[model samples]
Target: MAKVDILNTKGQNVETLELNDNIFSLEPHKDLMYRYLDMQLTNSRAGTASTKTRSEVRGGGRKPWAQKHTGRARAGSIRSPLFRKGGVIFGPKPRDFNKKLNKKMKRLALKSALSLRLSEGNMIILDDISFDTPKTKSMKEVLSALDLTSKKVLMLLPYKEEKYENVKLSAKNISKIKVIIADNPNQGKTNVDGLNLFDLINNEKIILTKDMVKKIEEVLV
Candidate 1:
């Protein structure tokens, strides 16, 4: 088991947690990480870009001219490529940007990301980042005290408003800092605080609780 020092919201050391070394201490798989991240990003695409094709364009139902008259090339419809106001021959269209992954793949991918975080020393088990008010400066102070200032942070909380709301908001003003609520549903939803590993995988602190540690161990084991 790997031991991690737990810190409270005050940036003081609280307790230490014993994490499963198998899960948190494994070597990160680069290929699996790439696949997982690719799937996540692909699923988030809207794929709604569409343009009117010649067949789809209106007013093209009628023939502009005879096939061999007027000394002009055979003319079909007003939407022909030779016409000025014609529909696009080749154009983008709406599509589904989702990638299909098995339940196991998702679980494995999440575990992989978590493993990478641990291997890179980016995971932090904090008691929580509770704040009674939305004091941005105080939050900054707390982050600095934790030596996380200037770091793109991804603080996770067990539940919202119990703690870390102000800490989450305070990160809004910081250029490279971010705080995320952990355990939110992963049902292909996006959070402005970054819902995917791609957005927060860099230098953020992925906060974990004792319960979260247990859950991760249970899954990875």
Candidate 2:
């Protein structure tokens, strides 16, 4: 187990939290993390790039000129790849770029990423954070108090319900902060499936409530 300080919104340490060794203290798997990142980036691609081939181009029904008769080189369809404004050769076409990693591998990768952050001392366990209404100023004050106003922060809430809507809305306008849920209560079990590896690794800091930590440990352990 690893002990970490749980800080309040005012940047004061309210308590210490014991982290699960399985999730936060293990040695990071660099290769697995890389693979997960690659898979994520690959799956996110639109893959909608397309180009017209010679056969698909318009106005290419007949030969442009007789072959070998005129002073110009042998002529073919106007849409020939060699001609100006002609179709492309071996051009790109729409296709899937999705990459899949097994559930076990994904879970391991997430653990690795989390462990990496913890080892880097960039993970912050918040005692609690919320808002009565959606207000960016309130969120900014909290971040300032934590001395993370300019840092790229990833905040994980335990659930994404009406109760947390204000918190989510408050953090949305912050350009460097990203908010995500750690678990979905409707799933009826401990499911930390909402954790995103990209956000975890890309952000410079992480902030999560104690409940969110429990939810992550319940599933990851």
Candidate 3:
């Protein structure tokens, strides 16, 4: 088990939390992390770039001149690929760029990522997070109290519809701060695919609420 101090919004130590070693204390495999990150990024690509082929272009139905008498090579439609306004050859087209990993692999990668963060001492445990209203200043004060205002932060929140709205609005205006709702399809199981590796790597620190810790343990363990 890995134990971390739980801090309140004021940054005071409210208590301590014990984390499951299987979820937060594993040896990080760089290759696995790289693969997971690549998969996530590749899947996110829009892949919408497209171009028309010669046959798809307009005004190409009729030949410009007779086949034998023209000074140039055999006459063809003005929309030939060789012409200036002609359609493109071997051009890009729309397609899906999605990639996938098995449930086991995804779970292992998430554990590895969490382990890496813990080893680097970048993980912060929060007693809880709540907002009276959508106020940016309140969020900033909390960050300052935690001595995290200067760093890029990723905050993991429990999936509570009412509790999230204000927190989301409060943190939206802050630069270098992101909030993600912890979600798992199974009632008592965990799913790791929802996590984004780029965001995890890009942020300097991670803050998790107490309920989030329990939720992760319940699902991952």
Per lDDT, the best of the predicted structures is 2
Q: lDDT for each of the candidates? A: 0.69, 0.88, 0.83
Report, for all candidates in order, the number of backbone clashes: 1, 0, 1
Ranked by lDDT, the better of candidates 1 and 3 is: 3
Residue 177, candidate 1: Cα error in Å is: 2.6
Return whichever of 1 and 3 wins on TM-score: 3
Q: Which portions of model 1 show Cα errors greater than 4 Å?
A: 60-62, 184-196, 209-211, 218-221
Per-residue CA lDDT of model 3 for 107-154, tens digit only, reads 788878888998899999898898878889989999999999899999
Candidate 1 structure, TM-score to reference: 0.81
Which pairs clash in the backbone of model 3? Answer: 190-219
Model 3 off-target regions past 4 Å? Answer: 66-70, 184-194
For model 1, how does the per-residue alpha-carbon lDDT over 1-221 read when each residue is reduced to its tens digit? 77788887666788888877666766766676678788888988999999888887767477777777489878778887667877887788999988876766665666677778887788778765567666678778877887887677766554444345666776677776656655455563455343355754665677666665675566557
What CA RMSD would you report for each candidate?
3.5, 2.7, 3.2
